[model samples]
Target: MAAPTKTLSVADQLDQLQAARKLALTTPVYYEKIVKGVLPIIGPTAPIELRRWGAEFLAESLATPVLAKNEKESLTIAVLDTIKALLESGDDDPIVLKASIGAAASAYPIVVRWIIFNSYHPDPWEQMSAIKSRVFRIWDTAPPPVKLACIKFAQRIVLAQTVSNGQEARLYPGLDVSLGMITGSHPILDPRRMEAEATGLLDRMLGVLQDNSSDALLVDGTLNCLSILIRTRPSTSNRIINCILNFNPLKLANSPMTPKTKVLVKSMEKTTRMLLIHIIKRDPNFQPGAPGSQQLGRIQQYIQRLERSKTEIFDEAGRKRALADQSSAQYGDTKRQRTETPAAVAVTIPPLGPGPHRYSALYTITNNAGLQSFDATQVPHQLATRIVVKTLSSISQGVLDFAIAGIRDRLKTFQPAPTPSFAGAPPPGAINPATAPLGVEEGDDDYEPNFNAAEDTEQILNKLDNAPPEVPLDHTEALDLGPFTLPSPPLLDPDTAIRLAQAAASRLFGPLSSLKEEGSRKPRAGINRLAASSYDRESWLTVVTRLATRSTAGLESNFKKEETGRLALNDTLREMLFVYILEDWRRRIEVAVAWLCEEWYNDQLIKLSGSGAPLNYEKYALRLIDGFLNYITPQDKVLTRFLAEIPELSRELLGKCKTLCGDPTTVNLTLTSMLYLVMMRPPVRAIALDTVAEIWQEYVDARPLAAKYLTKWRPGFIESQTIGQSSAAASA
Candidate 1:
């Protein structure tokens, strides 16, 4: 007789239900089962696991695009009662609430469309309305995931109820159930009421953004909703943007930041930035003072404020920059060491020599255990074939002995007993254990050894260890067939590799490099190398210059005589500095001025230390100044500002400035340089006045240009110069 059927336990039933759910969701033909079979299994009376699974299944089935609109509509009608029961059941299970609310979100619009079309079946609409009401009642008190799901659900309601234009209707069909979609509203279905409900829900979502103490999940959820609504609904864009404008993403706490608050701040700022970027990109044709220009401007300004707040909240201690400074200091020290001893640490490109004429090993066999455990299939096909061929080639008599011994041991350990030679028994050729030979077993008999089995296995292992090495396959040599020879593999050693890379780079960058040089011959590299004018390079130069100039005053005081003369801007670096400035002096003039000022200041510091000779500071300073005078044109006004900003105006530098007197432009340039020193640079004012007085007495070309600004700037100097001229005339 057939065995009686066994009943499944609760867990077994849940497992079967899960299996069915997966099959239904994965298979397109079984998708209808989610609404029909799956919907009946989830009720108030069902198990929680079954209900959770059913809720999640309905959620996926409804949200998925695989199901057609009519299929989804029917599914929505079938699952509305279950969704309402799941939401109102007050299970407090996050999975149930999240899945049920998510399902409701996907089903909400379909049910609204159904009610709009039929106007007779109001049951689904009422069920969905009840589900939404239950969700709202628990939204504030629910867990974060459930609350987030409800926020999305509310967004769907707003999108479905809000009236879409004709263009939007064609884009996303059947989503809108507005009065605009149909003529004459029925008593049961009021698009106006539905729209008002959506409006209230939108206000509620915005309220989360407005609250200073809202949860992080809620705030992010609300911003996400705003992003969707603003993109999908054009009518709500302005109000949403305005709401985002006033929302402070970092207003979570007024106290010092903890780890939790830090996470919240980061999440909120990231979401806010993404949303602002999205909104700005939608209408990026921004013209200042235009009709919609103010809105985008406000958004940009808000993003700036958000960034500043992030910096303040997260990096207020400057830890990131400090780490960068430490790293740069370490790298700078290493670079300095290398540059100091260039000959000792040479990097000569090694010559290309013929490599060993043998194929490379596919994998190194570290030990016998690793070799035994290694899987050849895991390797690539080409390598696996090479390994198999190599292994077969290396097989020897000792290896054959080891393989035979291994097979004998495995057979003896698992050998079955011999049965009598009958119809369904062992065959006539099967050995009887009593008459079997050594190391073989039969008929429940133990293995018989002619000698010690342990000693024999050890001898076989030793033989395996001493097996002959495989013959090497040399790919470098040509393979000769009966009438043909195959070519050798290509050589890719270090020297050839370097040469290949260099050739490729030269081909790609040859024209660009030439263009860089040609452009460098002029004032700038233009597009050839715009990095010369980049702000990062400018900031780097400024920072290092200030660090050396402002921070080295005390270092010179306690230094040994030899170390006291060590300037941050050494000879080679100074040469590079001069070239950098002369290449693009107009744009990088401030960098040059800062370096010169630092040099001048450090020169004073070294002088106070009573060094053997004047430091090279004056040498480098004069070189930079002369270089500028030589390279800068007569009408270039940038050099005037550069010279004025120099802290110390030495006599040698002033003498160079007094000699430019060939034309009106040259005279004006010289006079402007001297005038800026007298007016803007306070510390150099006296020396500049002295140079101006000397220029006024000595050079007639610069006198006319100097008199205009000097009269207003240094009236006393001009008068005293006139008196000195009179006294000199009287004495002469």
Candidate 2:
């Protein structure tokens, strides 16, 4: 007999729900199902834990990018009614209020987009507006978290409803409903009214900064949202920057300066500095001579003031230093801990041109006499004119003609005989006036000729004639440039060639086997796989695919080591693939699918006695599926592509799904995947239908959903099963 089933209590049910909710966050396939279950639990009458869990889940789901915009719109329509109830519940629980506000923020744009396309649909906008009203009413008296959320919601409203000019405008038609989108009159949506509401909300945000008594937390939140608005909405940038400049972080100061207060002050100052810098960096009008340059200057000056305030007012060390300096000044003591000299003032260098007529040195010279400074003005006009005239008249006509004749003779003449050295030699220490340098006079105090130029030139010619004929570099006799005979390398068979190559590779990469050496102070010898030049996604894909699909012909001898290496390679590749997909699965879904298909096909070939060892293809495939499901949202188009391209469904894979799926929602998703296969993938339709039939017969929770599809695809299958059951009952 089968064991009796056990019933779970309320606490157990809640525990199960908590786990399911957490799991559903990562597994997007079950989002709608999870939503349906949690909507009722979040009501005011449910336990706080359940309510809190539901609210947080709703907030994160709406905010997350995992779900596309259209999907979020659909979810918003479903959650609107629940959100309305939570807002009206009058619960002071900050968690509930904060979460509801956040969900509304994420949902508002989606709801507005819906209203834009379907102008006749008044229900969504009305519900959203009602949430808006409740939030504004509670905002004034709400706690810190709730109030902050309210500020963010206001920012979103402005971003959505306040249409801007130029590229700042959203490109998508229905991304956010704006006044400019509607051309004609509408029954429900008043573009002017929505825009005005957004403007008022913006004023409220700016008011936080305007008011001197505003809470530091509120100021911080206001500044944060303003930054986002400035980035995304160019029209609002000028106004937002002006308002930020007017506000001061020091104004939010309180007495006694608790640690919390100090932190808050520091945070506010940092945020303001960052925002101002961002504005300056991105400002279109900030270039030199632009009209906005003045504004930029003011912003820079304000930042400078804030820096000074940070040091003189808030810095403990700076404050202590200032106090010590004050005491020293009163006592007239000059010694100090550290003193900084005043910075040298910058002096502008005059541009290159004629200078003033007043005497100044053209250049200074040092000589045996003394330092002598030369002035251009001191030179008489006659002397300057004579120098200019000499420079102009120095070129003579005969010089060029003589130079050309000399060159023609040099090229036409045959090689000349070597010249002999001078027969007469000067006495030791005697200077030769005939070999004197051209510029020095014969009787000058520093006059000296180190060598006779005529003799030196003759000696160079003699050395050149006696030297060996110039040998080309390639024919140097000192180095044997032989076609040197190396004993003809013993013929290397293909096996030996491959062995030598493998040995070289092993020697080079041997350090990779052990990552680190024991008791060594030297830096690590192992390679850094995460270095910038290391393998990227495409490289890893190419190498791993080649390794996966190529034949292992001669490697069959050492089956044990080969298998071990194959498994390690598979593990590394699988890990790399998972990380690559996880980083950006939306765009890379096709990559993952292709890899899985290749793995499955390769596994089949291995089963047919292919040379390479079979891998844990199914293990990694299931792991990837698990991870992919976590990121999936309801009705994801990427999931459709995945299902369409996946390999043929197998019994073992389906049986594993059956083991893992314990809930109706997960079972429903599994059935949907199979149903998609039945409709879209014609080659696998029969197999997918058979799997669905098994699911329908086994999972009582999945039968109704399964029957809907099976009835159409496999006509009369359910009805025939019912008749068979009735006949068996009647015979028994």
Candidate 3:
């Protein structure tokens, strides 16, 4: 071989020259030669082919893995130097600028890492800014993944500056732009992105600390991000605090420190101390004698210890000097030797008297006609019991009695008409009053004895005599006369009442059973009949429909029919009706109670005597004293209403409740229904605590049957207690 025969084409010669020129631009050791040779090639007529070949060679060099690490670093610095020269050259060639940017991107990671690690270099901050600006410009037009990487690099630069004592702060001039890249255009930054990128960055920094154990740089960077996060997004601060708190601070304490790490630790300690102080100050439950006082005391003690520790960390010489100063200060402290006086004795008031149930009387009377007419015909016994209970529970005894009296009085007004008078013959040409007179004649002398006047006089005499009055002979004869006596109105019969009761029970319970037996052998026809018949009467059908229409769809089909029947009686129909009635009653009661409270609060008795001015002080004092009284009085009124209506409705409905299955054991069922209704009403449910306590005391004192029902449902009482305890714990 004649050593490749030296047969070079013009293109081959030009390529060799371009490769040498590119190598000179990348190597810092060849800076003088490149500046001399490449600086003069920038004129308009400069060889286009040679310049293009040089730029291509430079771009290719970035991908070479065989380059030594030191050589690669040298190449990065040289490329940056050339970029600065090109930018200052005032060359506005789009192609050249684009080529330079592409080349710089290929070597960006290597350049950034080198510059960051060697941040102590004199012009490192300036170099970082230059690099960052270049990266951002390229990133604006780059693919998403590349843009994301650029953001990551910017974060690294911020971290690097934070570690270097704020030396590179100016490097992150477009921080908001960088954040936009990471979070995209989402209104609320996606937590998933935050977790992946931001969280991972912190974890990586933490990993660096873990691996190196003495990497103050990494620790400082992590703390900077944490501090920024705490300031900008306070809700996320708790999460970061939890993360740090879970870590053993003692491990970090044992690690070697640069002065920077020690400063960071001090800053964190101060932040924690301030946070704890604020938590303690704002919490009213932290005070003594308050509900959770003991837990508050423990937390206070822990915070005090932490505060003391922080003082010790900052006050090395002051801690020792403070004890000596305290001893000297106490030497002449005569005021400290004086004993404190005890507080004046408090006047004790006697407890209040028993509530209104003691003074009130409760009774029930059956509407015999209503009972007989509807007992077994139209009403099912179970359903009738429900309706009776619902109606009775909803109204007060006073209201019920008033309603009954009104209805009876109205009935009496519809009495039979008096018999026609044909006893005397009319005078010739004298028209009969009933036949001829369309209107009553004024001043008529032939006036007959008024039968209504005689009847009123007879009733008055009968009332005064207090004896059974004799029936008149003509009245007895009129009773036998056709068309004189009216026919008896239809009374509520037992069978009809029973049918109504059963119908109600089926309507309430049947749907629940059908839902449970959807795909089973039992036909859903009976349930459908029950639902259809009682749909108008039961309110829970609406609730059931709403609940069934939720995303979870329908109720389970595996429920036992008997169980569902019982539940319908106890939970759905009775409960819903009770809640409805109670709510209506509660609203009315609250209005009355609030008015009474306002009146009592503003009463003359509550004001100071003989003062023209309003006695605001005395008025407030009386409110405190009479507040319980005001609450209880209206409460009693409401209870009285409830007791009157509930029991009567229950008794009436129960009497009517004889089902096809025969009279179901209904006393317990009725009681359960009453309890369900009372408990389900929001107002009643809200006051469950006060109500239970009041009722329990009454039960002890009066031993009423209603009290016995409350005792049977004691689990509800315990649940309220548990809730109170949990609330107390949380406040503590």
Candidate 4:
């Protein structure tokens, strides 16, 4: 025996111990042996071997399964008893505590199950609750990893019990004691556990309130926890707000404790104010009229009390800090207060562009229900015209009401009747019934008189003597408004005015070639007539002058040149002038036509310009001519081209006129006028056809009640062209 110990070196002894521990971990009997053997050795200053052995034994005990229900129960009790003893052992050693935490984590499920089964057993939850406080105490002194393990254990136990049974069943009667342990532990403050712990605590706290139906408990618990969390971590503020918003409102409303309800409400208000102030101070473009304004308002009201309670919350210093923080985050650097002062607020209203004005008007009309009831008649003529012109010029709401009013007025004034002058007369210098072709047989001479000339004359005289005196024919003629008078002469020469007018007119009325061949066969007589009336070079010049004057006045001060220059050479300035002139003329003409149609014409044109059936072509023609003369300016080349071509077409169709004047109501004529005017401008000419096509497509897509009208109008226009062309060819 003397040399037996010498046979094993220190390394060999350690190897033997390692082998035994592995065997204990793998085999049930060996595992129990290790637990019983190592428990007594787990104390302060224990040999390093004994410490290792104790840790290994605890790990094995947790993994080992006890047979039979009774044995499992006994094993769970033993594990809890062991944890309790270790907690009371007064060991502050980190390694020992870490080992204990790991062991306790592993045994949590078994302990929870046992406690649930023995809930009626004397102090079943109480015993575990006592251990819970110890867990927190150990966590406070332990390393971060060990602390994390403790939180993990708590989460697992809660999750396991909750999955098997609802929250009420899982949270034991003494659950508050364990919650206190968690609260004091401040697990939610741990960076690694913050999100999960916060979420769990929120759920638990809310569940407890719901089950107990006690607002006081819930409000107090939640507020206290939130206050602590907010102080430590402010980033979770948004997430908490979302949770509160999602909770059952009815439950909160029905809370038994009014005081508690008030407190909760106050807390919510405080949180809301904090969020809003942060957002407003940080966001430069934040406005009360933005999309989320309503939601933001509700939040603001919620926090109004808090704002009053803590007036300093929004003080200059706080605002400065918040701004500094925001800037720091944005630029990822420390920010300093700027030495320069902020710029002063601008007071003057800036001039608007056609695009912006039109867009603004459209947005207002489409999105704002309030504008629908505005009375067009109430608006001033100049303002209304400007609005309409600006809106039509681009697509903004800058002058929405004005534009709408202008359009309404124009629509009202549209006339359905043709001018008597155009309807009563043939083309200038054309043959009249009063001056029929010479040498034409006047009487029915081919049919022989019943008797010789003298006898026939005597018989005719006898018959005339016997016949009663002839009655005079009563004829009524429609009144004609005189040719449109231009307010002023245009700045441009007659030739230039004609060219510009033609260009403008073509933009409004597209080319005949673009129409279908069948449709092209008949040109609406009214359109031709209107074209002829508008073709008066002098009248068109007057229109151009009026338009140019209005446009020059309406332009934004910033863009206008201080000094005058040649209008033709300055392309940019010329383009601006051209746009302004067109816009001005269009608006004025629309207004004038609306007055004429609504007041003078008795709204007849609007009714006549239908989609189905033929329109009163002559009437539309007269309206167009009148509208152009009233609105067009002399410098407008586009309008001139459009008007110039109309007379030729009108002349060709006049030969086929069965009556002195053709019918004014015809879809063909209306479309022809619209198309011709659209094609007058080069830019408009390029897109006009496509625009009309798209409009038709959209009309069909919308399934509007007026779809039939559109369809019928398009075909009728074709018929008018066909009829016109046939008659023209025949006359030629």
Root mean square deviation (Cα) for candidate 4: 39.6
Note the Cα lDDT for every prediction shown. Answer: 0.70, 0.70, 0.44, 0.45
Best by TM-score: 2
Q: Name the lDDT value of residue 375 in candidate 2.
A: 50
lDDT of each residue in 666-725, candidate 2, tens digit only: 666677777777777788788778888888888787888879989999999999999998
TM-score of each: 0.42, 0.48, 0.18, 0.23
Q: Which lDDT tens digits does candidate 3 get at residues 650-722?
A: 2222222211012122223333334554565434432333343343443333224335655565546645755
Write the residue-wise lDDT of candidate 1 on 1-732 in tens digits: 999999777688788877886776655557776468766667867888887877887788888887778877877888788888887775678999999999998887788778777777778878877898898899889888998998899988888878664555666675455446645547576667767887888888888776754477888888877865775566676778888888887886466778888888888889989988877776433345544566877889989988887887777676534334576775565434654444643222222234332221212213356675666657999988888899988988765565556545544544467755567766668776666666675457666566644557888999988999888887655474456678997988655664564454334323332332222433422112333344344434654454434444444444356544443333334555567667867876766776776677667766777754346556766777777676656668876776756666688888887777544447767777877777778888878877776777787877876677678767777788789879999999
User: Lowest lDDT 10-mer window, candidate 4?
Assistant: 655-664
* lDDT per residue (tens digit) for residues 177-198 in model 4: 1221222233122223434554
Q: What's each prediction's clash count?
A: 1, 3, 55, 89
Tell me which of candidates 1 and 3 scores higher on TM-score.
Answer: 1
> What TM-score does candidate 3 get on C-alpha atoms?
0.18
Off by over 4 Å in 3: 1-13, 18-51, 87-95, 116-120, 134-732
Where is model 3 poorest over a 10-residue stretch in terms of lDDT? 655-664
Tally clashing residue pairs in candidate 3.
55
The model with the greater lDDT, 1 or 4, is: 1
Cα RMSD, model 3: 37.9
* lDDT of predicted model 2: 0.70
